[model samples]
Target: MRPARGSPDTRSGVRWGMRLTLNIDASPLRRWHLLLIERLETISGLDLSISLPETDLPDQSGLGPLFRVEGLLHNLRSDGLFARASRAEVTVATDRPMDESDLVLDLGDGRASVPGRRWTLHVDGDAGEGALVAALLAGRMPLVELKEGGALIAAGRPGTEYGRILLATLDDVLSRVVTLIVSAVSGGRLRVPTLPPTEAEQAAAVPQAGIAQTVVKAGFSKAIELVYRSCFHAPHWRVGWRRLDGPDLFALKRHPDSGWTDLPDDGTRFYADPFPILHEGKLTLFVEDFVHATGKGIISAVEFGPDGPLGAPEPVFEQPGHLSYPFVFARDGEVWMIPESCSAGRVDLFRATAFPGGWVKEATLIEGVTASDATLVERDGLWWLFATVRDGGGSFSDALHLWSAPDFRGPWTAHPRNPVLIDIASARPAGQMVIRDGELLRPVQDCRQGYGKALGIARVTRLDGEGFAQEVETIIEAGGPLWPGRRLHSLNSAGGFEFIDGSAMVRRNPLARRKPAAVLASS
Candidate 1:
């Protein structure tokens, strides 16, 4: 008993559906697509169940299902770029999917190839559903398989205009299928993704926007819950200089509009944490040089007068593991430096027995605590330290913690503001504090981009015997009209400010624009 030709069947459908039968041999990049599927459900408000083929992926290796879904999910959920879907459904065509809910698209020709997928995607019910299905089976037109979330509506109902939205929903699904099919390759692939980075985020990630600025946009894509994530293996640290770089010294000269100029050196990144004190007469700088390519970082000393890059980055402390965020200072005629030992579970103090490099471990300030970007301050005869600690499941670089002691040694007390600050945009310790007028001003890092990509200022609003409150004053972002390309914001000091600029590509020179990112190679 089929319905009359002109009679519309009204039905509001909501179901958890869809499946993925991946035909790939490796999982490093494949498993990621699984996560992409789950995200589609969240964004679309559909209870979607996305699955992969029944092959055994490595449990510990990159192939395993992990939290890859989580880290990306937040970015999507936190931002609302689309309206909720009222009614929509998806059916996938794949090989050996573990679940029964997944199957071939109802309109596609029963084959499993790219061309068939494309044709199925472009099909419209009015033109000829049969032709669409036949084209899908023949593999002439493509069947676009996508994991997506989108705005949709229940159609052909008795009295609802919002009843059924066919064209829009179909268009969105078609786009997703195209994007999903082509996301796996390199070169000339016109991808119609279910979701892509909103234009705003793309602007932020693009280079040379300016100094001290940032924007975060959530991407749209389906994702899966695999309880898997990538763990970064701490890399080794190396110290060296680019022979092609210009001199490091500056003449207090400022850029006409851009602000300042210093020769570019691609070695390690540092802020003005101060290592070798120039207080005795000569100028010395202590900084943590983080080597980007190797993922390792270290601490070193540099001496400079009017010229530049005093000497071949004098060796001070080198290690197989990380030794950075060095907060160097002079105490009672001894030079002490506190490098980021958060990895070693303690903050060790090294007293420089000799002038620039020679030093010995004099004490341990804190133990069993995770800290990084450690910077210290002394006022009213009390020593206070600042660093960012790892929050239960967030980036350690985003949370700031504080500890104080009568001296820089044991028995330190957690500041009443244990998490002296919680805003990731400006919490982690940056460069050393500089004396401003009469007040002490500290430079803080604003990691709006998952790393130190912006410089933030914190003014001491209250202090003395009563304690203190840090008031965030302002932020300087990368790629201002003057300074561009993810640059300007550094870790600590600038010269009078000094910070290892992360926004700028290594191959760039102040006089030169940072190289543009290579064009996308899609298939």
Candidate 2:
């Protein structure tokens, strides 16, 4: 079939300094085409010409060799037996020889051409509405190749979340295509790195069917518990501390048998996110005091002695929206805080105008991001900010993004690879990072079962402009008699004391028992 006429040149500011052609089937112009075109347009120096099967032919015989894309639009209409057979045909066609410079991106579901020569990819969906959604979500595409004998070559497991999986797969496909085209034109082999499986995929191998079944069977019990708790029990958090002699924060486990001394509360409110700081040879613990009536949290602090807290936690800072995760640190001879204010859609900085009582807004480090637990660290002459931001829609504890700046106050630039880490096991920052023996150790929330079900330690392997990486070293669960709860989330330390908080059950007050009626009393 004669190729159709070329579309208007949308090429603006070419990136790769080469001309390329994409010959896609005219009948199946799809959403994937638009995505591919949009991404390619971002690259400068490369002049792109999208040619359909009905477009007029150009005299390419004299151009030595041309970079081309083909065989991405078949099986769009066929289905059942015919569709399967057509897929097989498309796979076979991918192995055909072309100009060494010609790059073929085969996304069909069949045998793939040899790797290192031709690029092939596969998206796990049928060619219809499902396929369209998959194409749209694909931010990076995964590479797939079939050997001469139909052996598949790929890394990592498939993701459970369809949106994340599709986006990553599509992103990989486009990235690989760009690498191939750029290398072919520049006479340099730019190899695309092997991508790890998405967080959903890495976590999918664990079976949750039995757990889900149990939850369903216990629905009545859970409903009754919920009703009772709502009517009587309010969430109350207390701070537990262990004396640290020489920065062996992990030694807090040794006193597992010692019971926790509850930080006093008025029963109308609860306290959490305990962060202790030492100033002028005195220890002051900061917490998120959440009032049940107001349904909002405010920053509060209390003095701690060698035995326990000196008095009640007094309010230090309060904002219009809900505030939690009072991540405080001492820098430049002043106290600073970066609390989680996701409700306000910004992460703001607060400086103590008066120690432990008065705090004023210093600056808004990051705006327009629904960030939680904005932890800051000064490393290698740069300030690094770690937070889990909710982008679009998903769990807030799964994706970790990083930003670095020369100064803490202004001009923060996001890491080149934002959302650098995406594992529910250790993505959310539970508390401030501690440096031990010149090594950075971060406290992460293990949300595999639920938010803050447990606490984990991740040792930083790499953190720079290129990327961010970490390995979970230790996991601390809520157990061992001292702290009895199903959730253990925050961890912090100051002076000779380390603080932790967790969940606890609250029962109905016995003092509020009803009195006998007036007639019975008189009798």
Best by lDDT: 2
What are the lDDT scores of the predictions, listed in order?
0.42, 0.56
Estimate the TM-score of every prediction: 0.48, 0.62
Model 1 misplaced regions, further than 4 Å: 1-258, 263-276, 290-294, 463-468, 480-482, 491-500, 506-523
RMSD of 2: 13.2
Estimate, for each residue in 19-108, the C-alpha lDDT of model 2 and write its tens digit: 444334312333434444545545545445443333332322121110010011111121211111222122112223334223433333
RMSD of each: 19.5, 13.2
Report the C-alpha lDDT of model 1 over 1-523, residue by residue, as the tens digit.
5344323222211222223233322221222234334334342223233333245444222211112332354432311111212112223333343344333222222233322222122232222233322322221222222221121111110000110111222222232332223222111122211212222223443332111111111112222111211111112112112221332212111112323333233323322233435557765666666554465666667776554456545557776678766677777877778878677877788877776777788888877777886778887788778787652223465445678788876578775434433444456676677556667767666543435545566667655332345665555554444334443334333223333343332221232224322211110
Best by TM-score: 2
Question: What TM-score number comes out for model 2?
Answer: 0.62
